[model samples]
Target: MNIDLEDELAAGMREHTADLKPSADLLDRAARRNRRRTAAMASGTGVFALAAVVAVAMTALGGTPAAPPVEPGAPPAPELLTVAMVQERAVAALAADDVQHIVSTVDYRGKTEHGEWWFDQVTGDSRITRLQAPGGAVTMDLWQLVRDDKLTMTQVFHDDRSYLVLERPLDGQRPPGPAGSTPDELRAALQRGEGYTLVGPEDLAGRAVLHLRFDFADGSDELWVDAETYRAVRRETVKHTPDGDARNRLEFEWQPRDDGSLKPLAVKVPDGYTQRQVPPVDGPM
Candidate 1:
């Protein structure tokens, strides 16, 4: 019975993996990378296990918990970066917006290991109050948990389901965009060209956090992260569009995620509009 269940589960995962669209896989790769960045900026260590736990909990619970337990080795409470040194750096960086410890997001349109140069949207939310596009225009709607640093997007609807979200995991690091540009992708993006800039750390909203900025010729991105858990306290973006600058700011407050993957929290939508989950694609991963 156990063997059969395992087989079924594995088969399901495989089918999901196989049916995933390239874009969703790219987003998933970016999410993993951002989480790692959050971990690094906060803890100075890569703790995939914690992320896995949070992921499972979030997926199962359908909403992020208000508070999550702190493992002994985990970064201290009131700070999410997970490291003392990183916490200090975040505090210092908070004094100024430019530098701080962090995990941030960016959109890239350049060369990569895949030999495919295309436009990719990347999001790295950490301990900050808001995120804006480079031109201060175009705010992306994402899945986030304000109580804990559980921020990610399972699905994104751009103008009534025009664009969909998908995700996947790979054996090695990936590069920017088209199904693989994530933190793992960063390893390769760095190899392809000069990667993002590491500014330093900072204090945001009375909390010490890290900050990192990535600028491309097209536009720029910023990240504010929690020093203890490496979770996003706030993220902002300024987008450069031919029309004008569009801005978006996402704020998070410390909460518990004892339930699961921080999602399905209250969504702030415009009046007379509604939020709904984009149905799973007909096929597998």
Candidate 2:
């Protein structure tokens, strides 16, 4: 076409399209290049004029520029539980709460002893005063016979003259408290992360709790902690045996240091008592 004719045609095009606003996508692209967004296309009039020329040329060619390669923002990945994160969370939760060593519950096997029991964290000394023993309603004092630094893992009571004691192998390295004696002990134990698996969140009794599992060769032990405070709530240990599966369930309660939970550190054993060896209910060595 002749130069004068082309100039005249461009002038006519500008007049017809001058009032038109730039396309939303084109304005967005221009704004990005300028390092700041311009909500109103008119704010960048010079850039808009050039964009208008490109749009008119494309329209005449009967084709359009491909939409800016829109990259969709990827959704955030969900947090995983069976990883180190859970270990840190579980450890932190227990550390924030400060309570006594432990107040224990009864065994859940051959015989049931329903009462409250606790342990001494600093001394490794524990005592359980039961309102009722294996027999019926009567006061009973449960003690573990510890001689020197070794424990025979026997359950001995001081209330009755005749007592049944199930003796297990001596473990010199074992501490004084029962297996699930204290959350403080567990807080330290869980630092390894391999000792237990955070089974995930769960509902226990009527409140929310997190279930942590520790696997054994013959069985497994599961611990539940309060969902909010992350304190110890309950523990269940299952043993697979030739006879059957022996299960022991215990619920924990924590008290302040000066709550009279432990008044006298030393427990007095009865002077005379007959001891017998037999299988035990929910026994732990």
Model 2 Cα lDDT, one tens digit per residue, 1-285 = 123323543454454477553343542353234322322444333233233334444454334444444334422222223424445666676543333433344444465555555565544556656656433454665555455665433344545565654344455554546665465656665675467755555556656666778887998878777655566777777888776677766677765555475653344545576766665558565
- Candidate 2 off by > 4 Å: 1-83, 93-110, 113-115, 130-139, 143-175, 183-195, 215-217, 263-285
- For model 1 the TM-score comes to 0.28
| CA-RMSD of model 1 | 23.5
Model 2 residue pairs with clashes? 104-117
lDDT of each: 0.38, 0.53
lDDT of predicted model 2: 0.53
TM-scores of all candidate predictions against the true structure:
0.28, 0.47
- Give candidate 2's error at residue 113 in angstroms: 4.3
